[model samples]
Target: MTDTGWTTERMPDMTEKTVVVTGANSGLGYEVTRALARKGATVVMACRRTNHAKTVKGRILTEVPDATLDVRELDLADRESIRSFAENFEADYDNLHVLCNNAGVMAIPRRETEDGYEMQFGVNHLGHFALTGLLFDRLLETPGETRVVTQSSGVHERGDINFEDLHGEQEYDKWDAYAQSKLANVLFAYELDRRLDEAGIDNVLSLACHPGYASTNLQRRGPEQEGSRIRLWMMRLANAVFAQSAERGALPMLYAATGEDVMGGEYVGPGGLMNMRGLPEIQPSSDRSYDEQMADRLWEISSDLTGVTYDFAQAKAADDD
Candidate 1:
């Protein structure tokens, strides 16, 4: 149990491993990819913009000359893009060691995805949900233990899932939708762990993590693009004053993804005041996030909405073979 005070320096050697990180072009995803690549993992930078992903890959290679990276186009807002990414990955790679669902949109003007779902819930939760389901088989087929690390948020505590208005068709609040999506991230992670256990599959671990008030563009870009100038400035000021570096914020995710002491269903965050800033540690999420019934319901809804379902039996069979 890595209860508290864990750093990325303790990450196990990742030589010969393969990792896919969503939103690898910037922020926490960039840091995670860089760290893993430095540790000798073959990292795939999955982003919506292929050009941006290529540029980031170049930057990473400049930093770690020996780093192995593959730039792939992956627009989480589009289900077809998710399917294509997964299919291409499966065809190119024989095994997958980690799938980090790290891409997300924060508090912004209410917008719908190409698929017509609320932007936050669509890209942050449903998109990754569908992606993970599509790639579960490859993960299970890997020779050793694999992991799926989903990024949630501390604000999830204030979130409430309105199943009646899952898409915010009835009403919309930017913060509320963001919080709900982050909560869904946790719910999905824990529920996936449970389902994996019930299926008697032990090699794949599902984990969730938060950045803990990291100073990433995620905070500013949302408001910069949609909110008032005052809101943008406020976010920038808050980040400069209170937020930690993106590298620091990424510790929880790196720990959960590669820390040997970590287990499935664990929620990790910064082990500081209010889980806001510090080294990575195991943290508790909200009571609602642990509601088994709600988790199951969300899973069912997500599967139906995304047209993606987990075939654990098939994956397990492949693993056995």
Candidate 2:
């Protein structure tokens, strides 16, 4: 079976699936959460702000009267917070079927997270990295199917990871840093897929997706700024003309998360105009994104950086037993 395209028709039955979506209070996250809840999937809206998440949960249940949603606090920039959220989730849920690693930070002024790492890499990449590792057991315990869908972005086309300056210690370019984080997302997903395949585990799939140029609050941190007034004006025009709705922007993720025949490490995104806006389309990963040497190095570095190391090779060997 080939998942060559996107639509809700191929959506897997969600009656018994439990989905966990980070940053589900708004934009793509909110829409995905709403749709999943409407499909009768129990969704855990893991967010940094519980207050705002409360509002979003209410809004979703109001529209999806029977939606099952739960709110959990998670500040991705803080490792302690990430740990706390994971522990709580483990205790609360018996099975976690899908994990949408979608929360992200984009091009904010040079600010370090609590762990003294670049905010984008920390939150967008490391946070999800840790979360997924913590929840690996629950996902594996599921009946026959499970997935961890990581979200990347088109900006990854311009990304290159500098091992010399992983923390952006010497120089900092917000856009570059952001791209690196997105690239890391793809790398992480691909590496996990390779591991799962080597372990001969067809029950799990690790995938990546992008929202394209969606008209969402994802840019509120950048274009919505006072200093970026010109960009702000341009955003209004671009959003009106080029961007799709939050619902449409979320389709790639929805498809990746729920579609049948979803191959591990497959990249999904909008097909129109530089992949900025359009319906969900299966796409090719960047050449740079397929560098196994770099990905292996990144896997090691990420484990070192996050202090949540797991040897996929060893796991595969154990699975062979």
**lDDT score, candidate 1, position 55:** 86
Provide the lDDT at 249 for model 1: 90
Off by over 4 Å in 1: 1-3
What C-alpha lDDT does candidate 2 achieve relative to the native structure? 0.87
> Residue 66 lDDT in model 2?
83
lDDT winner: 1
Clashing pairs in 2: 213-276
Clash counts for all predictions: 0, 1
The digit string of per-residue lDDT tens for model 1 on 1-321 reads 334666767788899999999999999999999999989999999999889889888899899999999999999999999999999999999999999999999988888899999999999999999999999889988888999999999999999899999988889889999999999999999999999998889999999999999998798867777748998888889999999999999899899889988999999998887789989888789999999999999999999999999988877677677
The digit string of per-residue lDDT tens for model 2 on 137-181 reads 778777678899999998888899889998788998888999999
Question: How far in Å is the alpha carbon of 224 misplaced in model 2?
Answer: 4.3
